[model samples]
Target: MDTVLTTRHLTKDFGRLRAVDDLSFEVKRGQVFGLLGPNGSGKTTTLGMLMGVVNPTVGEFSWFGEIPNHHVRKKIGAVLEHPIFYPYLTGQKNLELNAMIKQCPEENIPGVLELVELADRRNDKYKTYSLGMKQRLAIASALLNEPTVLILDEPTNGLDPMGIAEIRELIKKIAANGKTIILASHLLDEVQKVCSHFAILKKGRLVHVGPVDDVGKGAETVEVKADLPDFTEVLMQFPGTASILPENGVFLVTLREDFHSKDLNAFLIERGVVANHLVTKRKSLEKVFLEILSEPR
Candidate 1:
């Protein structure tokens, strides 16, 4: 796959404090890549360097295999904190001005408005719209250039549940069209649901980077209740079992990174232990995120 974005030893410092340190990663073409971290984990700083909004203290980044510059960045749409639009202007008028500044074709304006579901309210003044509508209009403005890659920093921040859902769905729709997305978010579930690949950052350092599917692979949590009074003995015999905790009449089993539910269930049968109830809660991205955050910095 072609690389859409790349950072090499990207670092940023504010006086004596380091914001991003030696951060390097690749966002492949057509992938929904997530930049995940806590409040001050350098997520925004990394994006800032990539978007040319903030100069890096050290290292470099590229977009579409080319060096950083306005010409290159114009092909990548980015929203760092919040999108700016003239509140007094109508939604359509604001987009028209943005289109002109970006040198985007006027013909694309209607299509973008429709894509953000603001076609009906295109003529309405921006100030009269709800917060969700405002954000959607911001998104519409970003699309004026029809960029191949869209970078969003906390796209769902400070929104109601319904508004969050709307932006999330809109992001999915954008990804469906084969546009590469690099989203910075503190929301683990949102990344899990929206991104194909992810990188975790904590205290200005990268802690993890991999495909989202790999988070749960071989790391399933199993809950089992057997008819026998003591099934722990057989469970303990399994070499792959990591930890087991008793819960009511059932056992919550945590397996090693290389073991899974199927292997555990088969192990019980071989030992002649019959389990009346078996449950496997597939590992969620939240589980993986918590694990990353809890690790020593």
Candidate 2:
């Protein structure tokens, strides 16, 4: 429940266009916080302001409880863009060189290489490795200083399916290690795979912020309608029905995980009643995201 980052009326204006408008939110300790939006939703601008690369035209923000400085910046490892290393250098050599420049201990090298699962390929030339391996090496480089927080912007930008999967697994492992992560991504599936909490942005404004479970429409929803007018009375008496609400001309029924739509049809048949229509909706995070975006602003 510790607050790691907080913003108050944070706004950024480039001339007349507002990039981030009165953005306010808190990122807590050990949470994978995702900033999600479309291509021009101000996600990158928000991160840049927090990292001190871009100045805010209005409002303010804090890391922990105070303004960020050089010391605070060191405690957070960030990769805003694809890190380009010497293509001919070995993976281990690349990390060692980066660590040297950061003044981090070379002793942290082996552990980080192993943590990223790249120890076996430490000596392989960067250009000779696959796309997935290259991304893993970038993660290893970021962890050289043993940072408490990690900021990644589109970490899986240019990779194949297998490469994306590999990076997802690596990020999950890092989250398991208890580092507070701030991930800015336009990929809904990517955020769903890793973030416990997320904030959706639309045109530089926050539209939604809550836990992943907040979007739970249901496990599976079934819409049932019968010819008889008093069918509701019968369904209310039926067992295994969690909720039954009339919507339009049909009743929306949600059943327990062990129950299925066929169970309801069978139950009605046993009571000498029949449903004229039935429909099923399987819940998913992507559906929720799309619904939120489709709502009127």
Candidate 3:
């Protein structure tokens, strides 16, 4: 139960193109796992293979530490494509219909609607709902079975900013409820916000995989600029200064392992050199993502 899913060398091909190449990773229980990449980078293709809708060219995967079977499938809920619901049907009615098809009890309808925050509007026709409401309804339908794992591909693809924010909060709420979530997205910022761990893919190959906190964790750098012309020289005298480089008229100073921005600032003041501008340049996930993709194949 600790390892929720595992893929070993899972691959897939279509004609002359390989959509997924030797991809391997693990999803742990209660983790918000992210499959991140740009379009055609195999995010959806990998999800398809895992959900058993698309067969792998070669390789294998397991769910709950066992080969995927009908039983295992029951423990997973997914929304791989844009959802379709009867526009005329009320939200509650639509969920009832979905529950019937999923063989889930009608009693689960009220709770699922409540969980998605659509309970207040449950009696409204699907046609009367906003785009965000529609998306929430799709998620509610997927949750009809109370699956242990939820798989969502580009859940907020076309939503407005408000819609996206709503979905993001809902996802966090779902994760807080102890369900394992596998989210595939090209939205780097969103992934960084919600996913505990992530694996990046490029042209069907896994380029990077690790916890979100470790994205840009090596060798910290600080951007410092002082009014003094000898600022760079003065900075070099500090014991914690690792390397100093000029970038955009400012000094990009790499700090030694034990060094921090506060330490550097104090050292500068003691040396009679006060920086006009000093700030720690924290690396964003978008930068790391571009760097990973830019590497030679």
Candidate 4:
């Protein structure tokens, strides 16, 4: 796959604070790349610089191998922070204005509105639309130019569960059409479901970046649940094991790489402990994110 976006040691500072420090990553064409982190962890700042809304204090980045100039930025569509629109303007009118500004054909307005499922509501004033409707309209404005790369920051914010689901499905459909997507969000489950690749940021630093599956590989700890009160004492005998915590009458054991699920159950049975429920924890992107964020900066 060809690289759609690339940044080398990208750094952004706000006065004495480093908003983004030495951030380096690549986003490929036709892939959904997730930029994940907690609030104030520089996810938004990095995206701002990428969109050319804010300049980096240090390092460099490129979109489609070209510097972030007007000529190149035209091919990229972005919705940064929140969807901003004139409150009195109708959705269709707002899109018309956006089309004029982007130099896109006026014929593309209705099609973009339809893509976002807001064609029926296009005549409604922006202030009268719900949060989800506003968000979808914002997306429609971004799609006016038929950009190859779509960058969204917290796209699902302020939407109800059903609204979120609608946006999620829309994004999946958009990806299926071969458009590259760059999503910066704190919603871990959304990222896990939609992104093929991800990068974790914390304290303005890039702590982890790789394929989504590899983020938490080999970290499948197991949870043993039994009526036995001496589970802690029994778990202590397992060598090469990390800490074990007791929760709701179950023992959640974090094992080292040397141990497996079979080894854990066998060791327990060998000691005459009846295991009621023994299941390996499925590692998720959220777990990997927390693990990285909890580490020292």
**Clashes per candidate (backbone, < 3 Å):** 0, 0, 0, 0
Task: Find the 10 residues in a row with the least total lDDT in model 1.
Answer: 75-84
Give the poorly placed runs of model 1, Cα more than 4 Å off.
Answer: 231-234, 237-240, 256-259, 266-276
TM-score, ranked from best to worst: 3, 1, 4, 2
> Cα lDDT of all candidates, in order?
0.88, 0.86, 0.90, 0.88
lDDT tens digits, residues 1-297, model 2? 889999998899999899999999999999999889888889989988898998999989999888877667767887776666899999989988988777889999999898778899999899998766776778888888988889888889888988788878878988999999999898888998899999988889999999876666445678899999898898887776888889998999988777788888899999999788988765666787788889997
Which pairs clash in model 2? none
- What's the lDDT of the predicted structure labeled candidate 3? 0.90
**Which model is ahead, 1 or 3, in terms of lDDT?**
3
Q: Candidate 3 regions off by >4 Å?
A: 86-89, 120-129, 245-250
lDDT of 4: 0.88
Q: Please, what are the lDDT tens digits per residue for candidate 4 over residues 82-198? A: 999999999989988888777889999888888888999989899998888889998998888999999999999999999999999988988898999999999999999999899
Off by over 4 Å in 2: 84-90, 120-130, 217-220, 223-282
Report residue 142 deviation for candidate 3 (angstroms).
2.3
Summarize candidate 3's per-residue lDDT along 60-175 as a digit string, tens digits.
99999999876677678888867679999999899888887768799998898887889999998999998777888899988889988999999997899988998999899889
The reply for model 4, stretches above 4 Å from the true place, is: 226-244, 256-259, 262-275
> Residue 276: error of model 1 in Å?
4.5
Q: Rank the candidates by lDDT, best first.
A: 3, 1, 4, 2
Q: Which candidate is the best by lDDT?
A: 3
